[model samples]
Target chain A: MITRLSWVSLLVIMASFRFTVDPSFYPSARSATQAPKEGLAYVAGLYVGTGVNKPDFIATVDVDPGSPTYSKIISRLELPNTGDELHHFGWNACSSVLCPNGKPSLERRYLIVPGLRSSRIYVVDTKPDPRRPTLAKTIEADRVVGRAGYTRLHTVYCGPDAIYVSALGDAKGEGPGGIVVLDHYSLDVLGRWEVDRGDQYFAYDFWWNLPNEVMVTSEWGVPNTIEGGLKPEHLRDGYGNKLHFWDMRRRKHLSCITLGDDYRMALELRPFHDPTKLMGYANMVVSIRDLSSSIWLWFQEDGKWAAEKVLEIPAQPLESGLPEILKPFKAVPPLVTDIDLSLDDRFLYVSLWGIGEVRQYDVSDPFRPRLTGKVELGGIYHRMRHPSGAELTGGPQMLEVSRDGGRLYVTNSLYSSWDNQFYPEGIRGWMVKLDVGSGGGLSVDERFLVDFEDARAHQVRLQGGDASSDSYCFP
Target chain B: MIYEALSALIGVFAGVDPSRGWLYAAYYRTFRGDKWFSASLVVVVLSTTTTTLLTVAPALIALRTHFYTGFLLLAYGVNTLIHGALKAAYPRAHYSGPLKPKLTHLAIWSTINSTLSGYGLPLGALTLIQAGSQPYFYLAYVPVVTALATASLFRGVAHARSLTLNYDLILSALYVAVGAYSILYSLSTILR
Candidate 1:
């Protein structure tokens, strides 16, 4: 008879199918259906709890493809900052890539997350080991006028040849904002560039495609004068919400393509279900500057910008008719923070912070995102947390699905102190591990707890309290 | 070092992390050998009781503008004394971590993180809550909140075991100075 130890070794060797990692917005496909296991759900996430006493930023990587393990953390790293968790891992490789020359490749090799106020970048150099990373550099924020006041660090992209960082303008930069180009290898400051006269340049949300062009979604920071974060009733609050293409080689702003009509919250320059081709998606594209609604900013290249309004993230479908329950969140936009396409591009994965759910759609054809499978991951959003404190609730922020299109990972509780001031203290912030396979369509295999009891994870908008908690209700 | 830090951070979040939930729970069973959740309950009860009591206490209600103003000044003076000591000791001492910071290594993780990150709304809420409370409550909330934040801020340092006596010694000196400033401030605002 075969021994039990032999069985374990064989089991470990046969890892299950997996999902994408490193990046939050873009879910890339892996070469294998599973990581060699039957229960492997390759998706995972890290949640940092700076607000709580036991504020341990956790790392939960789901290896089981069948019954996904939730609340999984390989370590207990105390992440800095009491507000806002880091977003989007910086890399191209799934497990730190080693170049053919035996050198380290940044793709999945490591991750770069900005310490917003530090005016510095916190890079976890995972090239040393796939599971554990080393700090590569602590690059300083750009110094303007000898004082780097609010040069908040947003997004970091390490391209095949160069690395680019976008900086939000001083609370009062006339145009959109600015972009800082750096040498990918040396991390040297290449040059500082700004947006066009009428463009509203926002930071953090931008996409860099192959060969030449880089697209940045306009938050319309300037022109619209969006210095403070997004607020309702701001008629002129639409800048960088549009897609601004910059020619990296030439180092100048090329053209600005409006996103049909939606406030550009974030943008991803990832493949459209295929490794070879890359497409752009801009979500939180709302007209009233609300969080709901989005216009997919698709581009494989050519000349014209192929934009489509895939979904109308209704305000609050269930309570649309009930005013008392839906008053505060009324004008509040439906929060469709991040979206992804399956490896075949036949399915779409969208994470809704306000609703706190990750949805799967059949996108076999371009321009249309047909709803398919769905799983509500007790989100990290306080605004949407079942007021009665029910178990089946959530505040899902960013999300990604596995390669074979099985597992999913979603984070809730974005924003920090600023959010506390704005949002109600209802949500228990944390990461929700979703196991997505079909037993019964899109399912919820588990709900891992990421929040500390005292410092619960709630949406920043809920910091203000009850009145502002439930206004979102739309069709 | 970065990945190590990240992995460590993730480690803390994983389970063995002492700062948050595991330690107290562990101390209850493994170390203190108390009942499950008992150790945590004690702290929770005490803190909650203290916070609730301070909410309506008379000592804090009166401190609003004048008393807090004095305390801020006193705290500033205490800060100067400690700043002078730090300058004398290291002169140019700067740190990131290691020799394995244990848990507390996070104390000086960064100046940017310490002074700013996520301090806004909570601080504002504290301010507003202090305003709503009676005079005695003011005394309780102010120092209590500061002490709690301080304890939370410094919790990792003591347990890390990697920190030197010098770190503790410096912390002691600063604690005393801040204590004097805080006590004076809290006591001054007391109604009777």
Candidate 2:
């Protein structure tokens, strides 16, 4: 009788296991918007300006203003090797797992961090103590190169079934860059994601609408052209000016819409948070024709996928203090390196990395984006200072919005090599918080500045699921 | 062969009480005269067979690839848990119905009844047969399903009603066990 009772008790315990899932996983974008403000932010700090061959580390900062260690780095997870150049890392499984066709029982616990320079991938377990994430497994560069046949990993986006990492080039650091699929659980490099190339080559950022079964991938130059920093000849000759659309489920390229050669280096892709919406925003970094940046809204028109240029930020003429790259142009281009949409899908934040400004637009109307607020901190010429009277080095590059859309975290590094070309004085990375008003505006928080003296800060991810971390199935 | 037989037997037993209740409603309460009795029985058999065929492709595809099979089983577990919770929350209502014998309504009701009575388990059993690459094993369900329909048609309405409450309690317990086991099995395969 005791043995039978023990078996029944054990069965009950096993049944309860199905209910176990990460609480951070929300079912809808609106649900994520209702989530509480995040208390911590994970910032990737690079050892570019420190003049040392030290490995880069991910720093966990306490963003909760009420906490004792608020505005402080609580813990750090350093990589094993140098020159990894950790750019954009993501959760292995996010709210995407809640998607209808999405895989269940996969927890959003591991952080998939890929090295842009090293071509390696590290799976960091954020469980037990999220503050101090520990490295669980590392896939060497040779394995990724051998399996995926691609190199120079750039963006890491967690899909419903697998972890998708977009590569910047082929094995030899050339054209035809594409995405590589990694197993969600094992972090194993599965293979190249693309079935048919279909003239789509240069890849930077890729995102999808799950319910609609459509994926949009934007492009930049390959490792060969990009690693040496933006060149005039490469800008004219090699940089990609097209946005490719794909059948996400079939892994087949559907169509390619070129934004014309005038608009070069279409870098970042931010699709609409709602899975049903077949529209998204992509940032074109610095048009060589006018040294201006433009944001294109790609959506389904009639039947075929199309794009319309919605907003443009022209270059600002500077009489003095121009970097060598900008001296010929005599203007600071609004190199909009990154753009993030609020979870509520109300406001769109543009990071003008070149002119030292972050612009907030009310994209409640996708086509007609009204510039609601703009703040300047660091530029090639102006070099604006913070409200706290502290000197700033680089302009806002990576933007991470809190789930509630009440606050925005801005980091000031683009790429280690590119940082040197733009900010010749060397970027002493710093992350600053901006207090967002209820309607639409930005104000710098005087007390919340994380000063990484020599380490250049790149992408910042919020503690739980952030606005950019997830894709939802429900409206 | 024994495994397939056991699976079919479980489906048959789980399906018996509801099938009998449906038969009682159609034969005695709703369609009392004419050829209505013959038509209602056909609807019951048709709906259950339709669901079985519809689910067979997904089950077969899942069997061929363990990745999808793991997720499919997990989905079944989650779906079962949800149904169990809903059942526990709202106890079964013993409705004699208005007994309006309309064809369209009969079709819908019979389909819903078949689904609720664990006809989906035939798809699970079919997946096992298909895994062994024996497509002919599916023929075994035809006679078994027909026998169940004919046997239930003769059951007295009083006896069908009397067995319901007890049958529901047993079914609820079965759901919990099946849901738990499905989740456990899928998790073991995927997480391992």
Candidate 3:
């Protein structure tokens, strides 16, 4: 028999463990002119930056923004691997005029999508309307390298009439890198670039410096084990982080940026995106692992980039009088994924795709980022672990900030099998929108929830591990 | 100058994980479910609690502490691995759903164990450098070592017969107590 006090304590314990995720901006069903009100389906599921198979699941959401309020599965922009699992999705400007302010030109909002399982690119044109949002035309993911074998696609973005993809050269000597380009309008394969042939170890990340110049950041040849520790040898034999610069005009590799020997955050090219160029040491936090997930500066003053490791974004924010923890439960938090920055360069949003949390930093100064805001997305009744029986994580992936700073978009989904294991509800994704109108403080817009309906297409609760963990959708 | 080439090589290499390690790790963590794992996980917790005043200090609050709170994760991870290995070998361990809360408890404990001193993680990725790497040559020791380790852990579970319902309740209570303690400890740490 439990005492009344003990029962009360038990209730408190259960209550604390039970997390409630509410969206403050649940866009009330407003008229088409009123922008998504509650129930108007936001984004279905987030494309955690797809590769080869589907590239990106990015499609146009054509809601009337004023009508029915609840967006129907009315129409979806069909992707190359339309029904397949896409790794992620990205958007770039249509033309220079659209990006007149130097923001990713939205003139022709380009979709960056690739099939991770299959080497293919997904270039899509999207028109956003509450009533009807979908792809204009479907373009085949042309061959980036001679053979897309082992190699795959991960991220895609658009630039002045051109689309750039972040791919890996998995095919031995064929290419350790690849970025296929296509004519935006014709969707025809313009040209393909591959350097370090068969370099299948190409990490996943890319960014465009200018209209015709793009930077590709990826893991060249380091092997990391999930639910495990790092490779001592790979750490020593590390193939430094690369920031390859490409000459879009000639569709060739122009130059590259190397961070000597350091793991780089798949990045977004902003003003101070260059680690070697200007000394724009603004206050910002770039967490490396759990111990440093809440960190400020990744580089400690290399005379070129940042000068000190001032800020910290640890897996657990308890140090700052906060009861937060990074993913993995033990050890340290891995790298923060789905990282993006606001166009104004004022806010930098990073998702702990591991322990469901998205933190916003005031990069008013890239070096010393002020911990502007943080949103903790929790509720893992059954903490997610890996198939091998390691770590628990429920990744809050990828963040995209609007140009005007009026809104911020975020997706909660799992990237790897470990994520699925940790958070079986991972496949059941959500695209959350935060109204930054409150300024630096990011608040959730609860009005609507973008439920990736296809998440549960299959069953078995995904066995809670890996891509093979057949859930209802792709079961 | 050469860093550019090196970066390219490393990026391409580390990006070939295929999410396999994560899958294996997840299975090992949640094997059949978390309930059973939570039971033994309680044993490990009680062992620690008996010795450390901190463990009994403020159960709930303590969960927020660094080293102390880790126990929750260790129990969970080790349980999953043990169960996964058992099921993989015997292939007849059937169970139903609605066993998440217990599984969560198991996950926390196992993570704690791994961080403390289990080669379970490293043994699983002796070759992995980052996440994805092409060709897949480096990480050979992971599967072999994990099989051996899980085999040994499975034998231990077999030795104990099977986890019981009463055991689950005790385990739950103990860990919850530990978490409460850890949260309080974290507050103190911050204040200090």
Best of the candidates, lDDT: 2
- Order of quality (lDDT): 2, 1, 3
What is the per-residue lDDT of model 1 for residues A68-156, given as tens digits with 9 covering 90 to 100? Answer: 34344333334543332443334322211111101112224434555443345555454444334445664555543123323544555
lDDT by residue for model 2 (B5-27), tens: 53454445333434333433333
**DockQ of predicted model 3:** 0.01
Model 3, A212-265: lDDT tens digits are 133444443322322122333443343334444444435455444444333433
How many pairs collide in each candidate, listed in order?
Answer: 107, 0, 216
What's the best-to-worst order under DockQ? Answer: 2, 3, 1
Model 1 score (lDDT) = 0.40
| Cα lDDT for residue A195, candidate 3 | 45
Q: Comparing to the true complex, what docking class would candidate 1 get? A: incorrect
Alpha carbon lDDT of each predicted model? 0.40, 0.75, 0.37
Indicate whether candidate 2 or candidate 3 has the larger lDDT. Answer: 2
DockQ of each: 0.01, 0.04, 0.01
Q: Top model by DockQ, which number?
A: 2
lDDT score, candidate 3: 0.37
